[model samples]
Target: METKKYPIIVEQFHFDMVDPKTDTNQNVQVAMRQVEPSDPARKDELKSGNMFEIMVPFDVIPPQAGFRVSGKITRVVQTLDYFGQANEISPDDLEKLSRPLIEYIETLTYQVTAVALDKGYQLEFEASGNQKDNQ
Candidate 1:
């Protein structure tokens, strides 16, 4: 595998269980967006080919399965040779850039479910689609 052009740093992570009773299974929904950095220094750094940030919010609903998970994760990505605009990043590149945060989501969910349900659930995401499967 080729090394990624961007380096990712997670700035924030928050996870919570909306429904603790995991009874029924529901699909996971993951969404991502690029937002202007609220910090002035970071905004300036973007212009200088330094970094940009993205917000990834996810929801896992296993209705009646004793648990529903929801959270938002923020990551700051360091750029190399690219700094024109956040939207300018291609969809594929953005997906690749956000891979680590997605894994974070998977790991956290597994850990939480293991302790709460007495069994661990594994979440896997494919590159081409939003489909997720729990094992």
Candidate 2:
């Protein structure tokens, strides 16, 4: 029997989601946003209750059963500008820019997928951590 788990794949990119009127990125338009550390460690700009909200795009469920759903970062590039001139990026800066994304990916351990089945789906999930603490 095929079982379903939380199939929601949430992939996030750090970007400033604001009205173009306020702050525009006309010069360097990127698919992903720049992740910055907040003053208070717990207060992440991507988290709720912040000036800029991180927009996550994912389907409610997968298209077919037994199909693999992936959340991967295809490309991460950084560019630095100096004296009205821009360069590709240095290895050090590239690593720095990709640090947060790398950390986020490390936390994934098949915990975020939620299967949508008629019943008995709960029993198939691996319950170890505070999975019951929040929900």
Q: Write the per-residue lDDT of candidate 1 for residues 1-135, one digit (tens) a residue.
A: 122234444444444455646554444333444445577775665554545566666666654455666667666666665645666777787777777877887788788788877777777766675556565
Worst lDDT 10-window in candidate 2: 125-134
Local distance difference test, each candidate: 0.61, 0.27
Cα-based RMSD of the predictions, in order? 4.6, 17.9
User: How many clashing pairs per prediction, in order?
Assistant: 14, 8
Colliding residue pairs in candidate 2 = 5-114, 5-115, 6-113, 6-114, 6-115, 7-114, 14-33, 15-33
The digit string of per-residue lDDT tens for model 2 on 4-111 reads 111223354322123324421112111233433356774443233212112222111122222222244323222322111113334454344434433343233123
Error of 2 at 82 (Å): 4.5
Cα TM-score per model: 0.66, 0.25
Best by lDDT: 1
Model 2 alpha-carbon drift over 4 Å, by segment: 1-69, 73-87, 110-135
